[model samples]
Target: MPRPKSPRTRPTWRRRFALALKIFVGLGVLALIGLVIAVYVARAQLPSFDELKSSPNGQMIRVHAADGTVIVSLGPSYGEWLSFDQIPTVMRDAMVAVEDRRFRSHIGIDPIGLARSAKLAIERRGEGRRLQGASTITQQVARTIFLSNKYDVGRKAREAILALAMERKFSKDQILELYLNKVYFGGGAYGIDAASRRFFGHGAEALSLSEAAVVAGLVKAPSRYSPTADAEAAVGRAGVVIRLMQETGKITAAQAAAANPTGVALAPAPRQNSVRYFTDWALPQLETLIDETTRPLDVWTTLDLNMQRAADAAVRANAPKNAQGALVTIDRDGAIRAMVGGTDYVSSNYNRATQAVRQPGSAWKLFVYLAALEAGHKVEDKVVDAPITINGWSPRNASGANRGEMTLRTAFAYSVNTVAARLGQEVGFGTVADMARRFGITTPVDTRPAMVLGTSDVRLLDMTRAFASVANQGVAIIPYGITKVTAQGETIYAQAVDRSQVLVAPYVAQQMTDLLQTAVNTGTGRAAQIGRPVAGKTGTTSSNKDGWFVGFSSGLTTGVWMGRDDAKVVPGLQGGTAPARAFATFMKTAVANRPVEEFDTKVTLPEWALEPDEESYFGQPDNGVYVDADGNPIDQPAPPAEDSTDDGDRVAPPAPVPQSEQNPEQLDQDWIDRVLDRTPAPAPRPTPTPRPAAMSAPPRVPEQPSDRVLIRPQEARPTQ
Candidate 1:
């Protein structure tokens, strides 16, 4: 009786057991409900990812020139348009078997597969192996379309959600197609097609079972397992995939054993810049082509890529090994179609055409001739080439002394340094600087006394632009690379262009162009002649530190520059020697297929248009604009007269038609009376004071040249 009262232990135990059973049943019921809800939600949301791109406008684009020349590139992912039928059947089967065996049975979420994976994962913490990818093709496709390459439980959950949504909306075949097209295969390839072509030089549909396994294996880590990019790693991965296939019964052991010797045969990717020169000319003008996003825009220039290659080959063929060089070609309308900044892009990105500021040498003389014509000088004007001094800066002739009193034609033909300097000094340096600036030479120029001898540093691009202005009859058009840009056929940006304007008098420009043509034909630029009406000028910097040839054809304008990177000089190679030779080489080959045409025939030649060989071509035909036939002057000069003349022969330009005596006709008779009286011409009345300001720094004196210079003649060996 006492024991019974102390404890009804057995009865109490039964009650506690009943309570535990009830709690367990309640928890099971709740868990089952939650799982059903999760399954339904996953099935609902999984297929939405396949409807549209999660990242719209995420396109990697390439920058092209006006001539359809590729320059730079943008974007990260590469995708191809394809269908499921295009994929290798083996790839789909293997991925389905290993990644999601129950893929066909599940709606979107595979809970049974997940449960088995969880159980095995827990059981084999020590069973180390290569890799384990339980993601189905749908899940992988969803992740590729919407998610970043981040590893986390959240990422996995999100992948599953998207996969479910994707599977609901897209057929399994569609998901597979999207997966193959979106997966990266490394080595700059973006999709299965790209990867297949890159790795095997064939289509993805043509892949063998072994090849399919190798590619499928790369889905986990493209860069790490790319057969073409990394051989040893890919072989090891392919072996793992083959083993998995055998273990999973996708392939037999005998079949895998027969599929031996895994290797990747690599092929080099072709360049998009087949017309590099055309792209180069278009780059500076492409600023307007870019959207705020810095995306690359396509530009179809006038370049023929194959012909461009021939042109570039011609330039590089002559370039000295490892030497620096630049080339540019454009249409007469200032549409640049081709360019080569250097011999090789992998070596340097310094765009010589638009970046290198070097002495234009005789090329600068073309501008000087223009100035002389505008200053009333005819082509027949004579100038004494005797040794002359500009404030102790003695300007000498390229040829020996005393090309004495030669016509402006011979002086320009010979590229006499002294004559050019004298004309520049007489016409006003400010005028020259202003003319150049108006013609699109944005680079700063110190219009000093030295500039008279063509001592300013000029880029090949600017030089060519200036020549183009002349070719267009003073219509100075800024060269533009990009013409228009679009995304999926939607225009985002456009290149705004202004037509050419009359810079110099049309006749003046034509005269100058004719001079340049003669330069290519018979002057220092003779090497630039390409069996066509190619107008060009040769330039050699002081001491040969730089060489240049800038010219234009009816269909194209081209410029070439040659020098050393270290600023070292090269011997026996002037602009006419190497730079012009390079230009001619490119031009001859570039225009071989096109008909030979003359300079712009529309450019009217002025009555005063004198040949470049005319003598006594200094200081205008009869005082230029200062004294027209009626002796009517225009565009008066600035005043504040001081010393009318400077030391040496630098006489100040006519004083702004003395504000009080603005009429040149009134002073005309007075000027004639003084000449007739011959009172020793009263030492010639001086005009305004001469400004004594130096332009840029002194001209560089070359010590020698570089050996590895580019565009070297086959026999032209550069001295060490």
Candidate 2:
């Protein structure tokens, strides 16, 4: 076998070169065939030219204030559809320089740029950096319109194919226009005009060089480079863009120096982004009111920008540190004028005004009192404030001391828990719950005696609506924000004129208003007083967890709530302290120019309520006389020893006397006769003394000088 070795021969250089060339050619041919197959697949999947060109831009919802001031734009906001000529030259040049310097010279994809990006990517890979992108503007347009942004090889191949197709079908100007109009800028902005408006409060045609640079810089990282998000970062990015513009000869060195981003003025968006809360609340209603939201629609909201500004200022200034606050303002017609969901929308977007459900505390008493009035109980009707136990649950006043007896008005104004509990029990908690539902409290109201003290939770908006019902003279109100929705200057939907539905009688509303007015005048809501007849109530939850003030004046209703987000106690918090003061602060400016209007003064009183009864006489105990259901003291023997047990710490409830036995009409006649000296009147009860210190009226708030004034204290109210 060894002897059979073949002769060794080396091929000439030409033969070896030919063999290498053949192998290279075969590989090239195979690559070309694979590329052809991929292109065919991608092309087959491509949309028609018309379909791609006519693709809709992002759905923009321009929310405007009642005065037509743009508050916010929800979804992906698009500005006016602009042609290439309408776009500013500086903006176009900046985009080209920063995004793709070879955009005009490239045929869909730039080989030079791709090779450079690959080199950089390879260099950065060792440093664990993100890969560089070399997508031309044409590629970006194609990706934005026809292909997904996934970073897979297949997606990139499709993107390249689409970009090539777009280049062939459209002019360079058209491609640029599409890119400028469809690019996603941070802050929910799409299109050059939208980005310009969002960042500079003007159209793209009005963008200055610096502003244009800022917009163009957002192409790399919209959120991180957004001027609204971080001005310094945006300015630095813009400086880079300016440098690129100068190097690309789109701008001169002097122009680049002059295009200082530091001097750029951004649009006047709220620093806290407070208006976003309102827009979030309103945007959902658009679907119900209109057929679809696929187009750019103009929403004429009921929000008053001035009021919104004031509300934001007040909440930010007054909300306690480490605590949150919410405020909502509505006109008499139920139009929500201002809403601050939390102290700052940036920190947390949980809408406390419309979404949070917390105990309303004594504010829930509004429904109980309204129920009593509807049940023929008068504000001046006497009710006992003695210690009471319903189902083993003992409710105590905020003061923790029982005020023996007082008029219904005084009890309500003072927020006497014992009196409210007794009234709820007598009037029936079912009726109280129904009354709350009538006033638009959508939250579940427990039909239990404890609910009379506001153990059930409710939203600030629901409580505000309940008060608005009373302010509307018993008419139920549905809070609304959108007044009209239009598209392309044609009205798509208008808020229909809803017929007013009376939830309570006019007289009942009037009577409830009187009680509320007294509460503001001297009771727990005194801090909420605005000089020209305001009516409202205050609510404080257990351990001072939640404080609330809901009031209405001058055809406007406003609600304020302060609390911790975790339902934990904010030590020393109270309804009249921070919440009431905030209400007054917001309302002072809220109703500054509105004409002073007084609540309806005509309230019909019950016959028995005309004369003062023992309980109504300065909240003093009765003179050993057992009162019947009519509150008229009857001549009866003293209660038995067992009835007076427990060391007299708890007063025995009045013995239930038959209503037929005590004729209220006859008693009224007898009172009239006694006044006329026709019959001997019972010896008048000894003049009752002033209320106890714990139950005494609050000190009068000093009067301010104006037709419509808020008597704000020089210093903030003490907590609790």
Candidate 3:
């Protein structure tokens, strides 16, 4: 009874087989219907064949130096388009051997190749091997031209459909031509012709067998195998391609051996790839200047290859090994002539000249002094360079001890911090910030009192542009690199000469220039002096984290910055030492052929500005003794004594000024001695005074030129 019941419930084996067959058939029909819908959808979304063929390949920006030398080619660069016949036979064979040996036999998709690739992938699973791709040359053409790089079932199906459609519409030769013209090779090169020129410096038709293998190897991973990126890796990859050529019977063993991938000669790279920094800075400007970027365009820039080479050499030679350096040189009209963002462009592409924001230190004083001049303060006006505390923040000069009283010119030349802080207060912080903005400082300016010493961060480019405004005789300058942009032999954009509005009065700029000129000639920036007239400011931040020298000479303004990327202190680093020296070395060569042009000298200087700063010449008048212009000690008349009081209400006599401290003038002399290669005689120091119990010590002075000096009668200079 149990056996009979089971048979009745389970039904016969034939009946069971028929039911399973029906279900399988139903599922197969559903799958076929879904595939049909997907094909229809994909076809609807695809572009017309003509539209795909006529579309621009990609955007390319070819930047040229002022002399028409190619500085850099950005984005996808395409060389002359080559027809199938124009391509070399070896190149065509190598590509086929490496990418798809069955390219000619497959009907857009190769089932056998896909099955082999799938089996290899399954065998290599968990072995840390890269998954194999089964894309044929036709499939690659379809994906590259008409589809995205998304790796998914939907994308694969669409790619397959597109490849089939292309095979139906175009001849095999036509498909190969499209594939060769649209594939991407590294270093921004597009198309076989471009790839050939990029790697071998020759057209596709002129490609050698080894070079052909090298170019063909780039098809798998362009960046990894790019000859310019890693020549050895590229050569090794080419060797693999050569082996494939031999295995596929595309070349005989002797032919492969003679190919000698290792002997392939790559094109020489640009003398200094650091030019990329300049091009990177200029590329963004194109977005705003032009309306379309789909077509290839030629950008004529203001960069001078000679100046750029000099700048690169100077930075490399002068920058400390433990730190980085950046330099920006612009014409008086704000044309960027040379830009070196770092010592090595390959290691890091961060454009410090245009992108990094760091404290400029004393260099920020340019704005403070300019505001004072515009506020009707004369360079001859006396300002006290003594200890000052504002809102609990005490600022000290580079010298620990203050030089009691000095002219504004003396304070500026010496870069006395106390004087700058007092001036910032007297002129109003808001006004100082406004002056900086007016002079083209685009970064935010802190209105705090300490900002007078350049606490706010700023870019080297902005600071250079601000100084260029002064060198341009108070005319505002907007730093620019591109001079013109052309596409298809037609001008798309051209720079206009529009630096008309003045940032400061000509007279104010003249006075500021006088101070800056003195700074370079005898002050903190003494190391930056070139034989010709030069005006510049040196900046060294706290802990020597950053050093900067920004100057202008012979109608060129250049700014140099040195520091570690991490903003860590570099021992013995000062703006006057490395940055200023770099500035001088670069300028000497940058302006060697240009005529020497002096700064404007229409504004007359005050008598004090022309005369020697006595406080600087002698140690700050110590105790009751003062030094004469002749450098002899002279006693001053004593003041009347105050009445004695036991209640502690009487004022205490001012503490005796320290005699061991070197004045600004003495610092200047020391710097001059170094520059002139003169060993200076050490000055005698007086006995140290006992410190008062309640008096706090001054901040330690940084090693720098902290004193001013007299412009010798023979070297008397007019206001510039």
Candidate 4:
């Protein structure tokens, strides 16, 4: 009877058990829902690897200029990726030997490597060596693409799981390909091909066995082994790789010993984030050429590799021994052809061409005078070079000496610092600033009297672009590197020349061009003379902090800048010296095979206005025929009243001065005295001056001849 009673069911206990079962079922359903949601989210977040791989878009690439002369690159590129099939067997074998000894046999998991790594770690732990890591190639690739480098037990567990999953989904070869393409091998490069190029200056296929071993070693610790990071250590470590390859039987001992004694030459140059002058000129134009939001883009730019090399060489070839330099070139269509950011792109990536915002010094006079021309002031206008202040800022000439009253043309030609200051003020600071910006000046401009004297800081690229606008006859086509973009062979973008507006009057451009021509012919820019009709302007920063030569031929425009990376000024270097000379040398060689073209017909001046007085402002002057704004001849009825005044009192006959000496106006007698100091004791030839006359004939407009405009110097005579 007692046993029967004990067998009675315990309803409370049964109720608790049933409730626990219900709770488990509900929790399982909730977990299933959460997992479905997570799967969807993860899928949505992941980009299609196939699409990314197949597309050759959303990338910047090198292209040719009109003359087929330069190489220009832009953006954090995923371009020109070399395929696995294209890679050399030697390189692949080296990678396998150095990174994964059993890459082909273990289906990417490499169990044998794992066992060996565990044993080593255990053995080290026994001896307190603290060694670690057993990652295979597949694990490394997964970590690179989908995980961070942060170390932790949980992270290691996850990496192993993902690697196993990846092995299940992809073949060993596919995993290797992904790994090869996704890894960063230092030098701002991501992928074996780019790494190959960055480290060896050639394609992966061209790498030697030693080079391959070096690259393989980098896979373990890229930054530590980067030649730029530490050249001596990197090269030294390469020897270890060669030895390891031999020990592993991947390479014979003889082969290892026979490898290049130099090891891998991964010393291309330190990649720099400093401004790139040429790229600065070229990028804005590319923005207009593609629609990046909708799809990937591949831009085929206009770049001439040879010209780029030449420009770089010219800048570096003649740079001050203690200074660095930059050079940029663009075609007539506003396409960037070639760009060298610095004298040594490898040693320094600081691209002065785009980013060096130093004072333009006297080189800024070009814009000051151009603005004057646009403001209805003739190049022959006259202004006082005395100690006058503009907005409380007094500017001095380059020579720190000023000349009295002189024609604007002469002031500009001489680069009279004081005269330029006055003209800049007269042109209206706001107007000049706007004009300069419109013409492509990128740095912040100081709207003070000193601006006329080039007190405004500007990058080499901006200086070059502004000059390009002037050379393009006032139609500013912002320099563009990329010409067109495509996606999966589908044309997506095509860049056409888009000149927003005329920066200045066409006549003003021609006049400015003519004025620059005179500089190349006889003034400071004399060293920049070319066989063809070329035009450009030169600049020297204060204390010679920066030197520049920006010029353009009919089909191309180029600029060169030289200076120190740390803003250390060079001694005694002027825009007209090495900078101009380099420009001239490059231009001469570049145009040797091309026909010489003249600037569009020169503007005929009405003979009423004085000869271009721009020179007086910059302490320089031009000697063109005197004319008026109306292009008419001067009708003044004044003959040289013979004996009216002796040569001594002959108004001191406005003397010649350097562009740097036209400021802080000095007594006409003092200026003449200085000129005399520079001149020979007794000159057989007398300088000619235009006399006041009432000529009835209309100003003679040189016919638009089809001959090359010669740049020879002879009393400022016209080649036409």
Tens digit of per-residue lDDT, candidate 2, span 1-720: 456544344457867898999999999999888866665665576666546544766666778899998777666766776788988898899999988889889988989989988899888897875546789999999888876767878778778877876776678998898888888888888788888887887888888898889999998999999888899999999999999999999989989877779999877874657888898899888768889556678899899988888898888776656789999998988899999999889889899999998878778899989989999998888888777777766655433446465788878766677788788998999999999988888898888567887777799998998898899899888899999999768899998646468899999999999988877764667667666778888877654567888899999999999888887555445676678778888999999999999778732222222222222222221122343322234476333321210001112222444878654443453665477344433654323333446654333234322211121222111111
Model 3, span 371-457: residue lDDT tens: 999999988898897777777667654324565778887787767777888899999999999999888888888897777888778
User: Which parts of model 4 have CA positions greater than 4 angstroms off?
Assistant: 1-125, 128-303, 320-327, 338-349, 377-411, 415-430, 442-451, 484-494, 537-549, 560-572, 602-720
Q: lDDT of each prediction vs. the true structure?
A: 0.61, 0.75, 0.76, 0.61
Best by TM-score: 1
Query: In angstroms, what RMSD does candidate 4 have relative to the true structure?
Result: 14.1
The residue-by-residue lDDT of candidate 4 on 475-494, one tens digit each, is 88676666666664687777
Model 1 TM-score, 2 decimals: 0.74
The alpha-carbon lDDT assigned to residue 280 of candidate 3 equals 82
Q: What's the lDDT of the predicted structure labeled candidate 1?
A: 0.61
Tell me each candidate's TM-score. 0.74, 0.69, 0.68, 0.59
**Clash-forming residue pairs, model 3:** 664-706, 664-707, 664-708, 665-707, 665-708
Report lDDT (Cα) of residue 359, candidate 3: 83
* Least accurate 10 contiguous residues by lDDT in model 1: 643-652
